[model samples]
Target: MTQSVLDKAFRDVVIANRILANEGVVDAYGHVSVRHPLDPTRYLLSRSRAPELVERGDVIEFDLEGKPIGGDTRPPYLERFIHGAIYEARPEVQAVVHAHAEAVLPFTVSTTPLRPVVHMASFIGARIPVWDIRDSFGDTNLLVVNMAQGRDLARGLGAERVVLMRGHGFAAAARSLPEAIRMSVYLPLNARVLTEAMRLGEVKALSRGEIEAHASMKPDDPAMWRAWEYWAVRAGCGDLLTARP
Candidate 1:
């Protein structure tokens, strides 16, 4: 890719990390990554740093096998495999956010399904599939620590934009950084609202048709950009707009 295009891509990936942290989608433990601008087989992710602290210098390139490219290695996220496997499985997904958002966890461990209750968050696709680590690993720590576990999680995610990891957290996918950040931020909001609504009994989530309406919209559409701009500014990361390769 040209220098400008590549810089823009990496800048957005770094901004996404901060934006998600500022929006409470990710804090110390979560991470965000983007597909390589020039090479589909590679991606850009931050070193093992807190999402809020990620900067341009912290970004590193990794191949499909989750190995750092260019021999410039800092420690990668242990779950870097998650990003790699998902990118391998879903070509259209350009960004991924893995966060341990608390609101979404209740539903993953319960019978209640996390459904979208409002229009903006109705982009929440699928019935919110829950991936149980034990199903394959069989009684181990609940981390997608290896490529095999990451691929299994991807299998459960299927075409959904979000997948809840039972007793762990959720992964949000999108065609771009902003959309994935939006999904990461909104999944917990949807869950919080749904949980409160359930207290009144029989909550009414958006219908499948309502959710489907946004399926055709581009991930970088105006709505997504508008929200991203607001969040980026609020997070004090507006410098991303002026960043160059």
Candidate 2:
């Protein structure tokens, strides 16, 4: 890849992982993915490492089938199946993020859904249905090594950008790495806020109509993009941010 494109992808991945680590959404467990340049059937991901430690050169290219391509020297990530399953199921998604954020994991262990506790969380809406892996398939485990199980996990996401893996973390997809990062950040924040509010015992949340109204709006607002750019610069991610994707 040219320096220009490589820089953009590299920075997006690094900064995103760093921010996720800072927010306590991801530690050594989560991974992120970006669509491949030469073939949409392929994507780029890093070998297993803490989101906090993801470096620019750690990114590696792999086919959507979860096979490494090119002459890249690094080993592929163990969670590579999640990225492959997501891309296979949703062509519209350009990036994917899987993280074990604090707030989201609670819903996984119980019947509770990652409901739209707030309007801003309407991106997921009532569609944040937990995948009943046991019911879907007699087998209930879906860790990284479970490739077929990962595909079953993607089935719960539908067309939405986020899925809260029951007893697991979150798997989100977006049109770009920044958007994926934004969703990853926002989902956990929104979940935490809602969880806190509900715990207060008396809190008001948006109705389905209201949530739908907000969600129908385009997510790629210029103001938010500008905010991301500003923060990226402040975080010293500008050199990579300025590069063309």
Candidate 3:
């Protein structure tokens, strides 16, 4: 990739981390990543650090095996495998986000399914799938630290845009960085809304037609740009918007 493309990718990754952190989708633990603009075999993720504290310099390039390129000695997140496995399994996905948002955690362990209760979160589809690590690993720390565990999580995600990790968080895959960030932000909001709606009566999620229409939103859509700009500013990364490709 050209310097401009690489710069833009790194900038967006930093902005994404900040946005997610500021929005409460992630705090000190979660991460966001983007596929390399010029090489699908590689992706970029921040070194082990708080999302809100991530900067462009913290971004590191990793191959599909989740090994950092250039022999960078910085500590990487144990769950970096989540991003690599998703990118490896889904070629069309340009970005991935993993977070342990509190609002969405209950749904992961409960029988209640996290469905889209608001129009903005229609991308969540009708029912969100939950992946319990114990099903395969059988009693562990429940982190996707290896490719095998990551692959199992990716398989749980399948063709869906998001998958909940039981007792952990969720992994979101999108066609672009903006969309991935948007999905990660809205997933928790949708869960909170669903939780509230359940107390009133049986929750009525978006219809198939509504989901099909809203989920069709493209990364370049003006509405998506508006949300991105708003969140970037809220995260004190508004200046990064100009650097976006």
lDDT of each model, Cα atoms only? 0.87, 0.73, 0.92
The TM-score leader among the candidates is 3
Stronger candidate by TM-score (1 vs 2)? 1
Clashes of each: 0, 1, 0
Pairs clashing in candidate 3? none
Best by lDDT: 3
Candidate 3 off by > 4 Å: 243-245
Residue 189, model 3: lDDT of 88
Which regions of candidate 2 are displaced past 4 Å?
A: 1-3, 71-73, 136-141, 216-220, 230-236, 243-245
| lDDT-based ranking | 3, 1, 2
TM-score of each: 0.96, 0.86, 0.97
lDDT of 1 at 124: 77
lDDT of 2 by residue, 1-245 (tens): 47656556656777766766766768788988888744688887877678778788787778877877776656667778889898999988888999888778887777755677665566555567676567656664556555686687788788877877766787888877766767777788788887788788866666778777765544356644765576566655566565322
Q: Tell me the deviation in Å of residue 234 in model 2.
A: 5.5
Which stretch of 10 consecutive residues in model 1 shows the poorest summed lDDT? Answer: 236-245
Each prediction's RMSD to truth: 1.8, 2.7, 1.1
